[model samples]
Target: MSTPTRKPLDRHALWSLLSEKSDFWTEVNVVGVTGSTNADLAEAARHGAEEGRVLIAEEQSSGRGRLDRRWTSPARAGLTMSFLLRPTAPRETWGTLSLLTAVALEETLKAVCGLSAKLKWPNDVLLDGRKVCGILAQAEGGAVVMGAGLNVSLTEDELPVPEATSLLLAGATALDREVIAAEFLAHVGAVYQSWNERGPASVIERWQRNSATLGRHVAVSFPNGRSLSGRAVGIDADGRLQVAPDGAGAVETVAAGDVVHLRPRD
Candidate 1:
């Protein structure tokens, strides 16, 4: 398939969209260059950037993801931003925040682009069974900085991998990156507020509904040279994965790992 031509986004137009929805996003900071928005927000948190402050970058030289994987961000083809928050939850509940962000992304994509994006355990968003978005979270002191990258208009030739796709490539031709970003922040802010008011249980329930990993045979690779294979049941309140291993007597709760959803060998 040939790549579709896209219009260059103007910073002023982006600002106008954000400003129109100022109630949700108060402090919008845009930069032309940064190592990574997540890193920038972490530094700002160390020095105390206000809560609800958002940092966006047009290009990231060193974007990061889980397991120290490099998030390949090529110029303006993707949305790269980090949002700061100081939730009142205890330190142990911090891990659930990433899943909450994924839920928010899934909802926003469906509502905005009519694309039913699903969460692939942890924080990846997949469209048509291919990765289109990724989320990363960091905790500093008592605050959390959540970073998200979405491929808005990248073509198949520009995609980082064959298993990766963009909104434009997946039949969302009318979608705009700035519009998507603005709407996403609004939805995310609401989800964050819900988590603050209700609890992790509410967030987990919403996450499960949008999860693609649930009910799938999967393998989780741990850093300590241990691994587990099972069918993903669901996510618990503490954000641990509940997996039912094949021929197992009991379900296993996985706290952390890189989960790969597998198909039964034919």
Candidate 2:
């Protein structure tokens, strides 16, 4: 296999592109490597870091997804980044941050890469039924840090799982990390501003429209060794996954879980 040319992100260039229109993204930090951008941002938020602070890493040594599941990608082969947010909305609506990021990612992929992506409830972004990105949001003090790991130039062998894919693998026209980063941040700022101004309904509507999970049969495994097999009915006001039980039961809302999309006959 031949080695692909992985371009390093130019923070200056990125800031210039973003600063022209985005009043939300105040700072951009690009590092060669880090244990986890999310960890870095979480610590910063606690220390009173301002909102709209973005931290991008070329590679993560200790990155994680929901439930602390390890998330890894080759150096400069993916978009591994996080941004801080402090919303004035009700605290209950804070849980929607990750979902909001997923929606923004879907828009970024479509507008920047020309690839139509779908949201797998909660935090995953899918392209052609394969996961292209994963998002995690952590709350610190009154701020929330949203992190995303997006596969960009990874080959099949570089994938962490068979179900995972990259922009290059997905046939994206644009492989420039700087371009994707700028476009993604812009989308995030715009979507977040809209959500804050118009309320959760704005983001929720977009999520449902681009969702790959809603109306699908799924099995959600919780940490307590219990699972719920149901059809994903909708997302509640708090961003919980509303699942209608298989046989007969109330539509249960799941705040956190491992969701597996089940086959039609399963």
Candidate 3:
């Protein structure tokens, strides 16, 4: 862990911040460490916990990403949290939350930190084509728990992977986790309300604007040990990646998979 000590988020201050933004968030709580914020919040939601409960963990020990991929972050080095949401919209559209959060992070980072962060299809936030954040959404008892891990101030040697980066590595001027989280949740509140009222069309448009996947050749590995590669053409209605294979062929919508962007064909 870095030598810099980070104070755990003050529940009073965090709740105050959330309240000023909107009533959508019911509570904001913090934990020093946890296996996964998503898991903890999901359990709470299952027992009839109200929506808009936000849980932040200063450190995650057994963090797992999509497809059970391991995700780890040093103490106080990243934003690791889960927000509970109960949406009246069709469950089918829930997948868009990941994409929506990615856009929210981009908006917050660019506005507050002036970092040129971008989004890869699905739910990865990248700075200079390297991932700086990942999002995962899980359902429990008619509610959703959306967790996001945002890297803030990791040294080059502390990075979990070569393909990953942190704000510090990306030349971010500000490393204040609370500021970033507040700004990001504001956008999340707005987007969630908009999506529930209008639909996902506008959110999709905003996500596309920050997309680094569109127009790139990608290989998507499926759970069935299958992989598909093609040029990412668009995002489907269900928020899946639309890929047009090499040469003229039908476009395939990938529902879930590990996506690797391949270099442009020579």
Candidate 4:
């Protein structure tokens, strides 16, 4: 797809743009907060927030990522939101939800912003091989909340980490956050419904199509301080990373890790 060329949109304009989309009028709450949208959404869910409810924040003081890593938020430079979902499946299948979300996000970026994005394993979105978005999925009670942050207009100076990037830096301009949000909600809702009915195999198939990690040499680091370097074979049925060492016949299933796709050894 061609890179998007548009100007950054303001908050009010974002809401207006989303208002024109279908199914976006339901229980969507936009907040101008000094803290975290994920935390707020978790609290809302604990208080019995309805499924499909969305919480969006303009700025976050304590934004978070997977494994409790700190996520940076610059005023209005990115999209920060959390979606509530109540699926009927067993909780054991929750790991697949993140991969499903990644596919949904990839579709949204391609469809709405005219920019192609790829999934970097578990949940990060990469634009031209730089991190542009992150997804954090958490299960609480009977509901699952998926939080996402997409760098929309952030410049290099605004990036919290050197490995991060934004749509603007990736050659996308005039991509309105609200338009992107609306499109994301629509697509994610559809994907979630499909997952509820057909299970995660189909979603995993879609994820593999957009994945950039498969077939690449990678370094996988575990929380226990062990690390392994191997080639990413694919994702198994449960959304675990399947990796294999050189000349090894057995592939290892990695349930959780920090996966860094490595450059091929020369």
* TM-score, every prediction: 0.93, 0.97, 0.95, 0.90
- lDDT (Cα atoms) of all candidates against the true structure: 0.84, 0.92, 0.87, 0.82
Total clashing pairs in model 3: 0
lDDT, residue 109, model 1? 85
Instruction: Give the worst 10-residue stretch by lDDT in candidate 4.
Output: 1-10
**Model 1 C-alpha lDDT per residue in residues 124-159, reported as the tens digit of each score:** 999989999988989888789999988987887888
**Order of candidates by TM-score, top first?**
2, 3, 1, 4
Clashing residue pairs, backbone N/CA/C < 3 A, model 1:
none
Query: Cα deviation of 95 in candidate 4 (Å)?
Result: 1.0
Per-residue accuracy of model 3 over 1-266 as CA lDDT, tens digit each:
34456666676776676677776777888899999999999899989998888999999888999888899998888899999999888889888989988988998999888898888978899999999999998988699899999988888798889999988888888877877888889889989999978878888999999889999988988989997888899997779889998777899988888988888763
Per-residue accuracy of model 4 over 28-109 as CA lDDT, tens digit each: 7777764877777778889998788888877788988988999986767788889888888767778898998789889888
Pairs clashing within candidate 3: none
| Model 1 deviation from the true structure expressed as Cα RMSD, one decimal place | 1.8
Where in model 2 is the C-alpha error above 4 Å? none
Q: Pick the candidate with the highest lDDT.
A: 2
User: How does model 4 score by TM-score?
Assistant: 0.90
